[model samples]
Target: MRSMEVDMIRTLETDKAPKPLSAYAQGIEIPPGHRVVHVSGQVGVTLDGQIPADPARQHELAWENALAVLAAAGMDHTHIVDAHCYITERSHLGIYRATRDRFLKGHRPAATLLIVAGLADERLVVEVDLVAAAGAAGPAT
Candidate 1:
């Protein structure tokens, strides 16, 4: 198929689960053509740059940020094909899964969550990165 120029990539703050809880978007979309995105590691950094002290809170932040990155790239959880999650506390795995599911809403992509020794930032409790793809809708311009 012919590819078109993609434009208008924007991030969305999904549900009101938490604000600035993570550095991610609820969703994203690129216009005109197919899109490929590489979301970077997201941590618990609120809009004000404050890191949540609680690991659970930070984990949510990381996922949120990661989602934001995907939105900026014009993709959402539905478009995600691969993902890597880094966590400091393994016990919080359940919490992470639950919070992540809140956004997924059934769009389960290929993913890997890892329990790490620690993150680069001391305040960060978790980090995530992922890749996504979206087919260009409509005809090429």
Candidate 2:
């Protein structure tokens, strides 16, 4: 059978649950037979190890790095079941949401965002970590 884009994971959105402030869902359900991947914290640091001074740029790049790790695990943003993000500044919430929504396309996964005082590197403005699941996923190398 030819493969196409499918909602492999289930997003939990319900009126019974508290209304979300943004596009994130209340939760997500990963079905049996699917495998999960836990991605480490991906910061805004570039491949060349340069962290941009601009918070928006940092937020955007952090998501980009997360997407890269997902792809490496043979998954895409659609496979993401949860996203845990941290931003240094509370004012960067708008920028973080914009960047995250862009990377996630139209898929709404479970998410949690935290505003922190700082990170391991003071130059870093944002960090994104993800939990993704896919079908018959076994690349446990």
Candidate 3:
């Protein structure tokens, strides 16, 4: 595997593996001493418990809420090493990617997208789960 370290996280890619089709890495190597954060899947529900009917809005809110969790952990989008996004409809892929890409801000992490039959709530059309890490390696590990 070939990798380059960005913000103490290593992004993995190999000629033997197929290149990622979108803004994501083929793999991510988390170095030692990095504090790993497993964030729960954030759905479309607003802080006030509002669930937007628009799929695009749901996608946006899901990402927003997930990022908020990262912020609480003292991390940001750049610290993310992996992510999985679930969407209710195949038709929502475009908006999903747009919102994801915007929030990621050119930071590509290992990622996957799943089209699911439905979420916990019918109105919750989108959900985002993330794995993030930061901190220097070595003794800290």
Q: Candidate 1, which segments miss by more than 4 Å at Cα?
A: 1-34, 138-141
Model 3, 1-141: lDDT tens digits are: 788887667888999989898999999988777789899999988899999888888888899999998888878898888999999899888998899999999999999999999989887889899998887542232
Scanning candidate 2 in windows of ten residues, the lowest lDDT window is 1-10
Single out the weakest 10-residue window by summed lDDT for candidate 3. 132-141
lDDT of candidates 1 onward, in order: 0.67, 0.84, 0.88
The candidate, 1 or 3, that scores higher on TM-score is: 3
lDDT score for residue 46 of model 1: 88
Root-mean-square deviation of candidate 3: 2.6
Per-residue accuracy of model 1 over 48-140 as CA lDDT, tens digit each:
999878777876777788888777665667776556788888888887777777767665455677898988887688787888777666222
The superposed Cα distance between candidate 3 and the true structure at residue 74, in angstroms, equals 0.8
**Candidate 3 off by > 4 Å:** 136-141
Best-to-worst order by TM-score is: 3, 2, 1
TM-score of each: 0.68, 0.89, 0.93
| Candidate number of the best TM-score | 3
Candidate 2 overall Cα lDDT vs. reference? 0.84
